[model samples]
Structure formats: structure tokens, C-alpha cells
Target: MANKNVIWCDEKTLQKDISGKIYVVTGANSGVGLETSKQLIKQGGHVIMACRRVDAGEEEAKAFGDLKGSYEVMKVDFADLQSVRNFAAKFKAKYDRLDGLMCNAGALFSGDQAQYTKDGIEMSIGVSYFGHFLLTELLLEQLKKSAPARVGILSSVGHAGNAKNRYKVHFEDINWKNRKYNGVDAYCEAKVAVNLYAMELGERLKGTGVSTASVHPGWARSNFGGSGVMMKVLRVFLYPFRNSITNSNEESAQTSLHVLLSEDAPQHSGAYFSQHSVLYRDKECRKGGWPMTSPNPHAKDMEAAHQLVKLSRQMVAL
Candidate 1:
């Protein structure tokens, strides 16, 4: 259960001067990624907007024209593993240090039917998990060079379970090649993989001064699921309660910002955070009756994380 009374931080609460810091944000054209980039720029951090559409990224970059920090648009289509490699190569060629990498870009519905990437993996898992996995791996040296660096993966509460389904990663059918396809389930599985990846990465980088964490930004009114029929149906069904539960893009970007800039963040390496608090593996209640964030059991399973990493490396031929 999530605490409805959680105190949410905003751009005004961020006061860190990240001057000379270089950060990368995927999907920086819209939603939480865009807002996160804005806040980072305002805090004097140079940002690289890694987007699939260079035109859209360049257009969005104009909004930060008068901001304290600057941003450059780079083309990166996560659906294609080769594009991810190219983006990382171009980044390495220009910059020697990477202070932060926010794996924020993700896909939800794949229209009326299931889809596969160029590499023959499920679209959702391929882009959301494998793509980010490769990018992070390619940039690990830079992140290590800029020790004390951070990597934030945008996960979701849906990874824990939906209102009617208890989501779990199906190791046997990780790509849904032999199983029935359900967009929501596939998305949940991908998020779970991301959380596990972050946890494992944090463990590996423990003494390297690089920290990794996963974040549930909470539901926001964004084009996340795209304008698909299913998304339209969901929007209509949840319309009555949208205002009470959904967060604004700025608000949703807070938790990630907190992990990236807060003084207390590094201590919680390998953790899942929501509403600025560490989400434990088991549910706990505060003295004031507030529900502390709790990650699903699968997200905390170290053995599963290791297995997934091994499988992911094999899938991407790393």
C-alpha cells in the first residue's frame, strides 16, 4: 500500500549546484524525463537529452533556452540495440565523464498486437530493459571515472502488482515468445527487470563510488501508454478518480531528483525509492499510520537479479 499523505518535493526544493556535472536523460522530450531535465538544468547541470526523435528533442531543448544549465539532443532509439551502441559511442567521443544517467524512456501498449524489436525480443522488454542495460554497461567506465555517480531507472508500482493481478517475471518465457501476450503484464515484467538490474548494479558498484537505484515515480498524466485504444479505455475508466490519484509530471520527477541530488541518497544504494523514502521488501507502518513504501518480493530477490543479469548479457551478446 502507498501512503497517500506522503510529502512530495518539487523543483523549488532542489538547491544543489551541479555546475560542471554531465548527466544523461533518455526520453527527455516529454513527461517525467522532460521535467527532470528542466530541474537538472535549473540546478546548473549540463544535460544530454537522448531521444529517439532528434527533431522532437531539439524542439524540447528550446524550452530550456534561458535556464542556468544547457542541454544537447542526441538520437537514440532504444528499440534498436545498434542505436543504443551508437549513442554511447558518440557520447564517449565527446565527453569523458558521466555524473548521472536516468533511464527514463519506456513504452507501454504496443497497439492491438504484440511486437518485436529488430533483435527479435519483445518490444517492451527490449527497449525498457535490455536497451538501458547495454547503455549503462557501455558507459560504466565514464561513470566510474566520475566516481560518486548515480544511475536512476524509472520503474513503477505496477511492477509490484496490478489491481487484479500479481505480476511476476516469467523466466521461462521472458520474451513471451511461447506465452500469451498481455501488454500490461509485459510492461510489468519489464519494470521488474529494471528494478532487479538496478539492485544488482548497485551491489557490483558498492566500493566503486557509483550508486544505482530504482524509482517508482507514481502515476502521472502523460503519454506513457501512447494514444492506443487500451489507453483510451483506461483513461475513461479512471477519469473520475484521476485528479485525486494521478501526479503531475513535475511532481512525479521529484523522487528521481531526490535520488540524484539529495545528501541522503548514496547511503541507500541498491534500494527502491518512492515518495522520497526507501521502499523496503516488507510493508511497515509508521507511528502516524502512514504506509511505508514496500517493494515486491521479486524486486528484492538477489538470486533472481543475478540470473536476470546473466540472461540479459547473453541476450544482448555482451
Candidate 2:
């Protein structure tokens, strides 16, 4: 369930001394990313909005009113593993430290047929899970140096009570060759992976002061999900309902920002937050048993996320 007061903060709410602190937000050209970046800029923080669209990204940067805070746009195509590595390397070489990383970009219920990323993985799997996983791994050092850094993975509430996901933990065929592809299912599974990755990364980054947590942004009425006819029709009928059912992007984004900036949750690693507070991680995840309902419940299966990392390494040839 979503908290009634999930959105406790607004653009004028917190004055984070981000003037010197550097942060990177992906999919920053629109929706929640844009709002989050705007809020940060309003507080005098330096933000790098990474988006696949250069023109849109620059337009977003220009909207900050003043480029004085070092607001800039960076290129990042999440579906491309090489692009993910390029993004991290580019960031590391230019900045001394990074204070926060909000994995704002996501692949939502796209109705498009199952497609592989440049790396040959399913589109949703590549963009939503593998891409962010690599970015976080490559940027781990700077995040640690900025001690007590926050790594927030934007998850979804739809992850609960869902099993029509077309495919199981087909760890063997992550690309989904044998099973039919369901865009919503893929998105849900990817979100589940996002939570698992957070837990896995928490263990690997222990003692580094880099906190990790999964956050549900609440159903955001944003421009995502583009699969095909069936999806298109569903979206049309769901539009009116969606508007009322989901919170605005900015409103939904508050939960993610809270996890990243809240002093109260400094030690909230490996936890999942819905709205502004931690919620139950499904009975299975809590009991050390695989959430049969979740596509991938084993948080320790970081090996899958790592495979993307390996592909990134090979792409960057690092």
C-alpha cells in the first residue's frame, strides 16, 4: 500500500547543499527525472542529467534557469551496455566525487515485442536491470569516497501479487527466446531484479558507507510503455483510470528522493521503501525463501546483473 503522505517534500521543501555535491540521474529528460533534477537545481546543486535524447536532455538542462550550478547533459542509452560503461567512465574522469545516484530511468510496461538490447538481452532486462547495475558498480569508488552516499533504485508496487510474467527466472535464457514476452511482466520482473540487485550490492559494498535501497515511485503517469496494438488499446482505456490511479511523476518521485536524502534512513540498506517508508518485502523475500510470485526473488543472484557488468567491461574493454 502507498502512504498517503508519501510525498512529504517538494521542490521548495529541502535545501540540500548540492552546490558542490555532484549527482547523476538517468532518463532525466522527462517525468520524474526532470522534476527531481529541477528540485535539486532549485537548491543550488550540481546535477548531470543523462538521457538518450541529446536535444531533450539539453532542453532539460536549460530549464534550470541558470547553468551556474554546472547543470549539464550527458548521453546514456540504457539498452546499450557499452553506453552504460561509457557513461560511468565519462563521469569518473570528469568529477572528483558523486554524492548521490538515483536510478531514475526505467522501462515501463512497453507493449513492444520482446527485443534484445545491443548486448542481446531482452529490452526491459537490459535497460532496467543490467544497465543500472553496471553504472553503480563502475561508480562505486567515488560513491564511497563521498562517504555515506546513497544509491536508490526506483522499483514498482506492481511487483507484488504478479505472476503472469510470461517467463520464470529463465536465468538460462535471460533474452527470452522460449517464452512469449509480456511487456508488463518484463517490467515487473525487471523491478523485482532491481530490488534484488540493491540487496546484492549492499553486501558487496559493505563497509564502504554506500547505502542501497529499493524504492517504489508509486504508479507514475509518465511517458513510457510502447509495445504494440494490444498494449496501445489498454493504455487508451487505462488513461482516464491511470490518471486517477497513479500519482503524478513528481509526486511519485518523492519516495525515491526521500530514500536518498533522508537522514532517518542512513542505515536502511537492503530494504524496500514504498512512498517514504519501508514496506514488507513480500512474505517470501523476508522468509529467506524465493518469492514464488516474483520472477527473481533471490537477491544473491547478482551473477545475472554481473553478467551485464562483464559485458560492459568487455564493451569498454576495461
Q: Give the TM-score of candidate 1.
A: 0.89
Model 1 residue 92 lDDT score: 100
TM-score of each: 0.89, 0.80
Candidate 1 lDDT, tens digit per residue, 1-318?
Answer: 334544455444497789999999999998989999999999999999999998998887787768899889899989999999999999999999999999999988554467888888899888889999999999999999998899998887767773345566688998787877988789888988988898899999999988888887767667788887778999999887665566677767877887787766678787877643222223341111111234467767889999999998998889
RMSD, each candidate, Å?
3.9, 5.3
- Candidate 1 residue 200 C-alpha distance from true site, Å: 0.5
lDDT string, candidate 2, 196-314, tens digits:
77766776778888888777766565665545677678677877655445567777677667666677545667666665222223433321111112333443356755553455455
Model 2 misplacement above 4 A: 1-5, 10-13, 66-68, 109-112, 163-168, 226-244, 276-318
Query: Cα lDDT of all candidates, in order?
Result: 0.81, 0.69
Which residue pairs of candidate 1 clash?
Answer: none
Q: Which portions of model 1 miss their true places by more than 4 Å?
A: 1-6, 10-13, 110-112, 162-165, 229-240, 276-295
Best by the lDDT measure:
1
